[model samples]
Target chain A: MSERTAAPAGQADGRTDDQADRRADRRAERRAERQAEEGERRADPRRRNNRAWLLVLPVVVSVAFTAVIPLMTVVNFSVQDIFSPGDRLFVGLEWFRSVSRDPEVRAAFVRTLLFSAQVLLLEIPLGVLLAVSMPRRGVWVSVTLVLVALPLLIPWNVVGTIWQIFARPDIGLGGWAVNNVLGLEFNYTLDATDAWITVLAMDVWHWTPLVALLAYAGLRSIPDPYFQAAQIDGASAWATFRHIQLPRLRGVLTIAILLRFMDSFMIYTEPFVVTGGGPGNATSFLSILLSKIAVGQFDLGPAGAFSLLYFLAVQIVCYVFFTVLTRTGR
Target chain B: MADIRLEGVGHSYDGGRTWALRPMTWTWRDGRAYALLGPSGCGKSTLLNIISGLLSPTVGRIWFGDREVTGVPTAGRDIAQVFQFPVLYEEMSVYDNLAFPLRNRRRPKAEVDRRVREVSRLLGLEEHLRRRSRRLDPGRQQLVSLGRGLVRADVAAVLLDEPLTVVDPAMKWTLRSELKQIHRDTGHTLIYVTHDQTEALTFAEEVVVLNDGAIVQAGEPSELFLSPAHEFVGHFIGSPGMNVLPAELLDGVVRVGDATLGRASVELPSGPVRVGVRPEFVRIGPAGAASGPVARVTGVDRMGAYNLVHAEVNGHPVIARTDAATTFDAGATRVLRFAEGRAFLFRDAVRCGALEPLDGRAGA
Candidate 1:
C-alpha cells in the first residue's frame, strides 16, 4: 500500500497526477503563509522584555556599597581588638566585662538613656499639636514653614558655640537676662543643676524643628475630605486628632522617634562645647565618656570595647523600637 | 433628621475681596438627595467644604436645622464627606479603619465592634476584615473610605465629592446603584457632587448647576433639562451639548442669518442673541414635518447605536441626534426643522428671550 502511494514511476497517468500534486503544494504553501501571519499576530516579542530591573540596579549597588560595607566593618571592629600597627588580639568577653564595670561608663549610659527619653516625651506631641493648629493654604503657611526650618539649617557645632557664649554669666545676653532681669542665681559653669537645664534647653532649641517639620509634612499631606468625614461622623476635636491626624502621622512619627533617639543618645557636641563635660562630670553622656577613654586616657583596648558596647546598646534600643513601630503600624 | 439652610451664603479666599462662590441661598430638606453639579473650578467643592463646616463663609450664614453653624469647626458639625480620592489609614486593618472614629469617641468596645461588623456587612467587607487597607485594590480602598463615612448612622448629612470618579467603568454602575440603595436604606440627608451629568441626574432628586462662581440654575432634574436658566446650563447638561447660533432679535422674532424663527416677542435687551436647541429636538432631511427654520446637512456620523447628523442652517453648524433606523448619506442637502416649543433664545448668554413650544407636544 505504501509503494502504490509513492508510485511516480509510470509515464502518462503519473504526469497528470504530478500536476495535481503541484497544485496541492501551492495550496499547502498558501495555508502556511496564513498560519505564519496568524502566529505573528498572536505573539508579540516587544512587550515581553520590558523588565525595569536595569533601571533599579544602580540604586541597589549604591546602597550596598555605602550602607552595608560600613555596617559590616563596624560589626567586625566590635568583636575584635587592635594593639599597635598590624597586630591584633582577640580576648572574648574580656573588654566587655571591663567596660561594663567602669563607673564612668555606667553613669554615662544612665544619663544618655534618661536624656533621650525626656526629649522624646517633650517634643513629639508638641510638634504634632503645632502642626495641627497651623493654617492651611495661605501666605502665612509659607512664612511659618520658612521660620520653622531656619533653626534646623544652623550647623550642630555652630549651635553649640552660639549657646556657649549666649549662656555666659557676665557678657552673654541669656545669662545676664536670667541672672539680673529674672533675679535667678544661674551659672551653667558653676552649678550642676544649671548645666543640665542649659543642655536640655539647647537640645530642644536645636532639634524641635526637626520633629515639627516631619509632623507638619504629615499633617499637610492629609486631604480636606478626611476632616469632612470626621465632622460628618460627629467626632470631637480630640477624637479627630487621635483617629485621623495621629494615625496618618504614624510613619513620620516613628521616623522622628528613631532619628531623634539615635541622635540624642549620641549627643556630645552641644554639652561638650558648653561645659567641656565640666561641673564635675554632670552632663557626661556615653559619647563624651567614650571620647574621654580613647583620647584623654589613651586606653584603646577598653575604649574600643566601650565604644562597641555603646553601639550595641543604641542598636538594640533602635531595633526594638523599629520592631514595635512596624508591628503596630501594620 | 435635620434640614440644612443656607441664606445668601457666599465665600471668598482673599478676605472676601474676590469671590470663589457667589451668594447661594438654598435649603436641603431632610432625606433628600441633592447634587451640586459643575465643571472644574466652578466652586462646587468650595460650597461642599463650607457646608461641611471645614470652611466658614466670607458672607451670609449657614444653618443646620434652626441653629446657625457658621462659626463651628468641622468636628463640631455632624456631617460626613467622601472625597474624590480615597483617604484612609493605610497601615490599619479594615476593622480598625471603620472602628477608629467610634473608638476615639470613647465608645464602648462592644458597641464599636457591633458597629464595625454591621458596616462591614453593608459594604461587603466582612471577609476582608482582618486585611490591612493598604493592601486592597483602588476600588476596595475607595470602598473602605466610603464605609468609614457611612458607618455611623447618626451623622447629620453625608456629602460625597465625586466619590465614584476613581472607580473603574465596569464597577461604576454597580457602586452608583449601591449608593442609591444605601440612601434608600438609611434616610441620611445626602449631598452629592459630580461633573458627570448622567451620574448627577440618576442619583440626585434636585440638581444645582454652577458656572464660573455662580449658581446658574437649580431645580428638579427634568426641569433643568427642559428649561435651563442660562445658556451655559443649556449647553452643559446635554450630551454633545446644545448648538449655539448667532442670531438677531428683531421685535419678537429670532433671526439666524437669512432665516427667522417665528415666536412671541422676547423682552430682551437689544443685542446679539444665541438660539439654543437640543440635538434630539432638531429634525432634519426634507423637513416639512415640523414648523421651524430650514437647514442643510453638512456631515453624518453613523454611530453603532445612533446617527449623529451635522447640518448648517443660515451658516451656523447644527447637530442632530437621529435614530439608528434613519440613514442619510454624508453631505446630503436636507431640510432641518426645529421641534415646536423646543427652541430657546438667549441674549447676552442669559435666557432673556421666549421659549419654543415643548418637544413632542401636540401641534409642535
Candidate 2:
C-alpha cells in the first residue's frame, strides 16, 4: 500500500527545479481551494454586522456632553486669553509659560509633591498595619470594615467642615485638649505649622481607610496555603511578612499608592473648607492654587494650562507606577 | 531526620464538639516514605497539618525523636510541607525560593547557596534557577516547591499534601518517579498525602488508608492489596477493587446463596459475613461444569488489556477480571469461582480471615 501511494508521488517529483516549482504552484492552488471550501462551509446568515455601538450610544452621548465638551472648553481656554465672554485672543503657550514660571505656582507644585509623598509614606504602612491587625473573620470583620470605611463614606467637603469645627481652639475638643491638656499653645488659624499639621491629619483621617480597605482586600485574596507553607518552612513572622505577605500585596499596594498620590496631589475641598489656604498660604496645594487662579483671579488661561499640566503629571506618575508594579509582579 | 510519634491525636475546627481527625495514635519512623491516602475531606490534610505543627491537635501530644513538640508553632517545629497548589514566593527567583527556608533559619550565605544549588539540580531546575518562580509552568513551579521542601536539611519530616495535583498529566508520571527516586536517595522521613491510589501505592513504602477521618488500614502496598483489613480498604485500593458478596457462615463452610463456596481458615462466628475477592481472582467457567457456583454474565467491559465481566450469582452482583483471550457474552450463564487462599472473609465489615478451598479443584 505504501509503495503504490509513493509511486505516483515519486513520479510527480521526478522532474527537477521546474517540476518543484509546478508542485509549489499546485500546493498554493490547493491551499487556496481549501480556504475557499472552509469559507463556504462556515458561511452563515447570522454573521452580519450588528453595529453594537447603538447599545452604548447613550453612554457615549452623555460622556461627550459631560466630559469631552468641558475638556474641549478647557483646552480652548488654555490656548487663548479670554478677557470677557466674547473678547478673546489666541495666545498659544504664553499662559503655560507664565503659570510654569510663577513663583507661587512653583511653591504650590513643590508643596503638592511633598504633601503627596507625606500622605503615601504615612498612610500606606499605617493602612497595611491596620488591615493586618483587623479581625480577619467572624462577626467583628464586618464591624471593623465598617468602622475603617466610616471616614471614606463622608463627603470631602463635609469632612472639611467637620475638621474645621473640630480644630477650633475655643470650641472644638481636639484643639482645646491640645491647648489645655498638653499646655502647647496650638492654633491652626494663625500658625503655619499648625495649619499644615491639621491639614495633614485631616487628610490622613479621611483617606487612610481607603488604603486600609484595599490592603485588606489584598490580604484576604491570599490563600491559606501560602501562610501554612510559610509556617512549615520555619519562616519567622517578619520573614513571612517580608517574603509572603508583602510580595502578594504588591499589586494592591501599587493601586493604593497611585490612588492616594493622585487624590492627595489634587486635594481641594477639605483643605479649602478648613484652612481656606490660610496661615499665609501654608497649606496651599496644587488644586487650591489652581482654584485661586481660575476662580479667585479669574485667570482662565493659566489655570487651564495648569490643569493640563496637572493631568499630564498624574498620567506620567500613574504610568511609571503601574509599569514598576507589573514588572516586579512578574 | 527524626521519628514522629502522635499520641491520642485528634483535631476539631470547632471546639471539641466534632472531630475532624478522631483520636488516634501512630508513629512515622525516620528516613522512610509514608503515604496518607484518602478521599477528599477525610481529614488527611488535617492529619498532615497536625504532624507539621500547623494545627494544634485538641487532645494529644506529638513527639519528634522523644522531644514533645505539641506546644510548638509550625515555625518552631522542624518540618517542611508542600501544598496541593504550588506555593512559591511569586516575586522570588527559583534559586531564592529554594534558598528561602535556609535563609530564614539564618543559615550562612555559603551554606544556603550550596544547598539551593544542590536541590535545584536534583529537581532538574538547575537551568531555570535565575528565572522568576511564578513564570514557570505549574509542573516546574511544583518542582520548585518540592525543592524548597528538600533544601532544608534539619526538618524532622517533609509533609506533601497532594503536591502533584496541579501538575500536567503527561508530567505527573515523570514527577512521581523522580519523587520516588528522591525519597530513595535522600532518606528523608517523607509523608505524602494524596487521594490518588496509584500515587499512594507506587510512591510510599507504607500506605495509611483513611476514610471518614479515621484510618481504615495501614500496610505495605502488596499487603494492602492482598489482605485489606477493612471492607472500605478492599473497595478503595484497586481499579475495579474487590467484589464483596453477602454470605452466611455456618459450621466451617461459607455459603453464598445455595452453593458451598469454601471453608474459612479460622472458625468464624455463625452469622452474616462478607466474602471478598479481587476481580482478578474471580474465575469464570462454563455453567454446570461441576466446578464452582453458577452465575449469569450480565455485562462485559473491554478495558484494553483485560475484560471486566459483570455477573449475577443468585441475585448478588459479581465482577470477574479476565484477559482479552477470555470472552463472555451478556445474559449467558457461567460458573464463578473465588480463587482459594485469595478469598477474604469479613465479619461485621472487619476482615476475619481467608477462605481455603474445600475440595482440591482450585483451577478447574
Candidate 3:
C-alpha cells in the first residue's frame, strides 16, 4: 500500500510544481497589463476635468442676486443720509453714531439679547425631553411627528393672530380658562408683564417644535446597538441619556440653539401683531426697533446702520457658538 | 460568577402567534466559555438578549445561581454585553469609556481607576487610554468595548454578540485568541454568539448548534465533529460539510446504488437511509478497483495545503479533501472508498449510528 501511494504522490508533486509556475507567470502578465493601462489613463488630461462646474452655475447666479446684491444695497444705505427721493448726503459714520447712542435702540438691543437667552434656555431642554419621550417607532411615531410639527407649518402672521385672540381675557378658550377657571388677570394688551409673557409663550409654542423635530431626527439616527450596549452596561436611564443620547445629540442641539438664537434676536412679526410692541416698549425686540425706524419713523439711514450692526452681532454670535461647540466636541 | 439556566425559554415578537425562539431548556455552567452558533436570524442573538435580561422571554423563567432573574432588568442582573458593531461613547476618552459602567454603579474612585488601568493593559489599550474612543480604528474601538465589559469585577457573565464583526480580517484571529485568554484569566461565564464556525470551534469549550429557532446538538467541538446527532449538525459544522448520499439498508448491510459497501454499527430498520461521510474520509483510487463505486472526476481545486477533488458517484456529487500529492484528471473515472468506522447513517434527518466498512468479498 505504501509503495503504490508513493508512486502516485511523486508524480502529482512534479505536475503541481509545473502548474504553479505557469499560474505565477500568468498573474505577472496580468499585473503588467493593468499597470500599463493605468499609466495611459493618467496621461489623459481631459479625463481629469469632468466639467462639474456647469452643475453649480444656477446656484451661484441665484445667490448673487438674492444675497450679495441685497447686502451691497444695505452697505450703500448705511453710509448715506437721504432727506428726500433724489436728495441725499453721504455723511459716513454719523448715522451709525446717532443710532448707537439712541437710548431706545440700546434698551431694545439688551431686551433682544435677554429674549434669545430665555428662549434657548427654556426651549432646548424642553425640546430634548419631548424628543426623548416620543415614540421611536410605530404608527404613533408618524402621528406624533405630524402633530408636533403643526405649529411650524402655520404662517407667521397667522400664528401671531392666533395667539392674539388666544390670550384675550374675554372670549378665547385659553384666556377664558386662565381668567374664569383660575381667576387671573390675563390681558396681553393691558399690562407690560402680561404682554411680555404672552409674546414669550407664543414664540415658544411656534418654534419649540422645530427644535424637538430636529432633536427627534438626531435621536432616531442613533442605532439600537447603542441602547442595547447601554442596557448591558447596567446604566440607569439618566446615565444612558447623559452618556449615550446627549453626546449623540450634540451636533443637532448646537444647530437648534443657533437657529433659535438668530430667529429670536430678530423677532418682529409675532410681538408686533400680538402687542404692537405693546402697552409699552416691553416686548419690542431688535427687529421691531429697526422696523420702527425704517418704516414707522422712516429713518432709513439710522435703520440701515442698525441693520448692519444687527447682522454683525448675529454673525459674531454664530461664529463664537460654532467654535465653542466644535472645540468641546473634540 | 453564576450558572445561567433557561427554563423553557421562548420568545415571540408578534405576541405568541409566531416565535423567534422556540421554547427550550439549557444550562450554561458557571465560569465556562460556551458558544451559541448558528446562521443569521437563527435566534442566537435573541437567546443572548434573553440571557442578558435585555429581553423577557414570553414563556419561561431564567435563573442565575438558583435565583430566578426573569423579572430582573439588565442593570439588576449584573451582566455585561458587547455588541457586533463597536458601541463606544464617542465623546469620551478610552479610559472614560472603560470606566463608565463602574462609575455608574458608584464604585469607589480608587477601585475604578485600578480596574480601568488593568483592563486597558489586558486589551493593549493602555497607550490609547487618553485618546478619544471614536478616533481609534474599529479594531481598537472594539477592544475598548471589550475592556469596558471586563472592567467590572462583580459581573456575572459577559455576553458577546459577534464582537469582532467590524474588525479587520488580519486582526480577527488575534483578537479571538486574546478573548479566549481573557476568559481563562477572568473566569467569567462567557457566552459568545456567532455565525462563524471557526470562531465557535476555537473559542468555546462547548458549542450549542442552533437551527430554525432550535438547538440541534450541544457538545464539545470534537464530539460535534465526530458524532453529529442531527444532519444539520453534520452539514453546518465542517468546511464543505459532510456528504450525504442516498443508500439502502438490506438485511444487515448498507447498499449504495448496486454495491453493498458497509454494515451498520447500530440496528437500523431495513429500508432507505442516508449515508454521511466527511470529505476527509472519502478516498479515491484508480478506476475498476476490486471494491467501491466508480466516480467521474469533475474538478480539482488546489487549496494551498490540500486539493479538493470533486467527483460524481451514482449521479450525486461528492468532494474529497485530498493532499496535493493525490492527482486525478477531470472527466476521468475513479473508485471512491469510505474509511472504515468514519461513515454514518441517518434516518429521517436524525443521525442513527455509525457504519463499518465491509471487505470486498462481503457482497459476493
DockQ of each: 0.31, 0.59, 0.56
* Model 1, residue pairs in steric clash: A232-B79, A232-B80, B252-B265, B286-B335, B341-B356, B341-B357
Tens digits of per-residue lDDT for model 3, B28-81? 999999998999998999999999888899999999998999999998999989
TM-score of chain B of each: 0.92, 0.96, 0.95
Q: How far in Å is the alpha carbon of A286 misplaced in model 3?
A: 1.8
Cα DockQ of the candidate 3 complex = 0.56
Q: Residue B272 in candidate 2 has what lDDT?
A: 77
**What are the chain A TM-scores for all the models, listed individually?**
0.75, 0.81, 0.81
TM-score of each: 0.78, 0.89, 0.90
Q: Write the per-residue lDDT of candidate 1 for residues B272-364, one digit (tens) a residue.
A: 777888888877746565445567777788887998998887777889999989877666666566766667887768876555543343223
What are the per-residue Cα lDDT tens digits for candidate 2 across A1-330? 999999988877866788879999999999999999788768964655678869999999999999899988899999999989889999999988998899998999899899889999999999999988997789999999999999998998999999998988999999998999889998999999999999999999999999999999999998999988888777888888888889878889988998998899899999899998988889999899898889999999989999988888888988987888788656
Ranking according to lDDT, highest score first: 3, 2, 1
True contacts kept of each: 0.57, 0.82, 0.82
